[model samples]
Target chain A: MRDSRGAEFDDFVRTRSAVLLRVAFLLTGDRHAAEDLLQEVLEQLYVRWRRVQSSPEAYARRALVNRSINRWRWRARRPEQSLGDHDGVARDHADTVAVRELVVGALRALPARQRAAVVLRYLEDLPVVDVAAAMGCSEGAVKSHASRGLARLRGALAESSLVMPITGTGSSR
Target chain B: MTMNDSDVRGILHRATDDLVSPPGLLAEVRRGGRRRVVRRRAVLAAVCAAVVAVPVAGVLDLPGNAGDAPIASPLLDEPTRGDLATDDGYLRQVRAVWQRQIAQSDDPPRGEPNIVWAGDTPAGPAAYVAHATVHGMTVGFVKPTVDGPRVSTLTQVTDTETDGLEQAALLGPQRDVLLVLDFGQPVEFSPQLRYAPGGKVERTFEPVVFRDGAAVLSVPPQRTKLTVALSRTPVERENMIHIDGTSEIYFPDHKDRPGPPLVRYTLPGAEQVWGIDPVAEDVIAPTKALAEYLDPVGAHTHNGSPLLWVYGATPDGRRLLMETVQYDDDPSHVIALLAGPQLPFEAVASTTADWSAPLPVRLRLPDDQGVVVVAEGSALSYRVGDGQWTDAGRNAALLPATATEVRVTDANGTTTTVPVGS
Candidate 1:
């Protein structure tokens, strides 16, 4: 029975690994770090495999955001680990790739809760209610996180040449 | 639809436009409906192991294959150290030797050692300890694995608290008699001490175990003169640092640095500690026990953030780097570079916007000879067999063993290596 169950779980994992990796990549930017983050989150999922199969994506997304936020938070302490243009690209050309860089920078600049809210609402495109459910927070809190996340992201974008527009300040959309 | 923040919103979408690769990720709503079926069965099965069943949506579509994506190797060969070396190596060696001694002790710790205090050493005014533990786990392969006593030094009379009738005897200025409340595997250590209002400080520690359980501590009767109750409230991790994802930069000194820090909070139960966004400069002159996981497979030359390497020194002072690069076919494993003791560099230096922003660079012994860096516009090429740097662009040359004085050529044909002094 254990073998069968493990096999079933393995089958599900193999089929979905690629998709999960993509989401993780988008969430983290660092491929290797993303893999590590995904692995840990998956291991956690494996520990609770039974309940996960029902709604794995939501659980995994939440875990990914939480872990990413923690990683970002901890990384902030170590100054030498920041990602800046080091590929020897010209300053003018640097802005060409700045879009991805700017967006990721904005996402990372947010507080953990706010980042999760923004990712869920904008990137993940989930409704406010679902975002709240995934984050284990109240709908009102989710609304606040989204608002704060957008505002912070906007502030971050202003520094770069690429400017972005955000929506939903605080009240109803 | 329309707003003043539209520019930023559009820019945000554009930046993250190609961030996700498999494309169908955001469009997974239909598949989610099907996942409901799988979650029901999974929950039923989890109930048997007595493990808490996370909600179905939480892990419904998680990846199963370890190598679904080309994985970067976490292990690598220790790199050669050139300059910034210290006796930090002694820390790891001592830990190993001490762990062996602790394991050989006929009377092992009662259970997992609850950290009483952890920080700097010598147990003096400058030193800081995390918390006290009643009992500690047996120093074995399965659970708690450390050499010698869990806490290296017992600094002051106020270092630990006691519970039950266990007694505290001053063994020495360096070592204190730590009474264990229980003596067995999976033991519980919970000590209650009388904390005088301001004098009795509550050091908030980051949460160690996500689950809540009862812990037992060993303490002397006199220490528990007053039983101060502990709150189960969760506190935000203060004194924190963050690594921005896109920039690959670390913001160590945030707006929250000088605030009142949390001293006592959580327990240390993780098998290993990982430092995510380590500033390259921070790793140059590292403290003891700061080792990190490096993934070579993940190394790639992005526009702004190119090479991302993670390194750390273990509880034993050995520093290692998980050097990652994008060109490697295998994006899973990291090439481990053990910077020699002479210049024990751990993490890579994060690049700054102004290019020359002064970042904190720690050296084991600043008075000693330091490293010199030269950036040359001339192309550098090296093969496996080549011994040193050559002007020849394509020829493979033997890589320099340590972080040494090197000439780096910027995008423009400019080159220079700065000679650094302690």
Candidate 2:
């Protein structure tokens, strides 16, 4: 039984931690902070491993998202810093890099909940119900956030002339 | 770029590609797990060796749907463990929750909020309170107990989002009549209710086979009324019921109770796990007289057991005290001192004076780094080289602890030596 439980927990961490880390990074804008968020969530999952393993990923995602939102409150509010045009970070795929930057920039600009909804729905490919579950909101609320987040992303990308570059077929520059 | 779902998915995928896990985290997790497992096994072995086996019967507290019940399988794989007995159980719990809400509502006696309850027939209930305007008279009620599975009677109400699904039991001759109310929809109700009078048997039957499954039943279009329904579960499963004729039903006059604006911290070692701005006009606007009637309530935990809770607000409106009741034991010590004369809004930097303040402890740091005093009302300041306490500005945010035999000079240069984390 102990072995099985350990195996189950390992499987959970392997499969879901990447997605959770990405969302955490988007919300926190720091890789170290994202890792900390994942650690906190994994610790929580460890404590409730037996009860949550069946839906371990879902439970972890919700905990991570909520923790991010809650963390935004108490800390000293920092002025959002834009990653200047992916500068040295952009690699071979210029369009992909640009799109990635656009997404990161757009996400950084959004209020926390909408960004969470977009990440859950479009990025993670979670169902509307699951997204709502992660967001602690109704399905309608999830839809509204998705709509608003998409609009904001579009507007942000349009301002940057990078929308067509990324979404238009990923043509190598 | 205006992106659709597919486009957005692509961007998110690429943006997250490089964020793979750092090496050694998994190893650390395994090491921790092994330690815990060994400890647990050792404890179990000790218990087994210490005593002769004594059997303790485990309590079987399964609800009505223990086996092969319709609502037994949760929609998602995760089971919702709570007071979900059946639809009836849901209705009872919803009623209890609402009754408490109504009694404790800070609203005046004249302002009765509309109560919305949704659930399954033999399940638990979920209720919502909304201050909205509704058109048409819709009365919702539950039938009394008749022992028997076949005492399954059904009544139908207007199929709308607000009204949700309707449920009822028929008794005596009333069991034969299917009374349906049509606010206007495709479905029609046949006047028959299923009941065996007095027996402890209520078996399930197709609700549509009875006339209660109506799209639109006829009633004089009543205007502006409060609506209530008693069912056994969440309304997510009851999307099939629609009140077609009631397209004009408006959910106007909505006034949700405002809450504090929350701020989350990403920096390391920040003691404030979560903070909320209570001074937002939408949150604590027009401070309630009851806000002054605030008192410390006992600490408790929420479902997921996070350390969060409400304790009491002040009367004069200068300060509001909140305790992270769910996070730890003895929440009284963890009270949040807000800025109002009672409870003020959350600001970037706040100084709390009331309740209790952290005792000013004098500290002396090593020579490389000066002593940085951190406390409320006063600013944190520290300087590197040989300098007077006046060298570092009062509002200096961070102070380096570098040199050996450093001095922890308070905002006032009056220095004292104390062990760190003592």
Q: Report interface Cα RMSD per prediction.
A: 19.2, 19.8
Once model 2 is optimally superposed onto the true structure by TM-score, how far is the C-alpha of residue B311 displaced, in angstroms? 57
TM accuracy, model 2: 0.31
The DockQ for candidate 2, computed on C-alphas, is 0.11
Summarize candidate 1's per-residue lDDT along B249-339 as a digit string, tens digits. 1112211111111011010111132233333122222212122221101112222222223334333333444332222111221233344
| lDDT (Cα atoms) of all candidates against the true structure | 0.34, 0.39
Q: Give per-residue CA lDDT, model 2, range B129-232, as digits (tens).
A: 22211221122322222421221211111112223323222222222222233322333222211222211112222223222221111222222211111121
In angstroms, give how far residue B310 of model 1 lies from its true place. Answer: 39
Instruction: Give the TM-score of chain B in candidate 2.
Output: 0.20
- Write down the RMSD of candidate 2 (Cα, Å): 23.6
Q: What would the per-residue lDDT of candidate 1 be over residues A1-173, giving only the tens digit for each residue?
A: 01223434443443454445545555676544655565556655665667877887778777877777677532221121211122121123354366666677667677768877776676556788888877888999999988988877766666664553433321110
TM-score of each: 0.29, 0.31
Poorest lDDT segment (10 consecutive residues) of candidate 1 chain A: A76-85
Cα lDDT tens digits, model 2, A1-173, are 12445445654564456557777777666655666667656766775687887788889889878988888532211001111111122234676556666677788898888888888888778899999999899999999998898788767755665444334222111
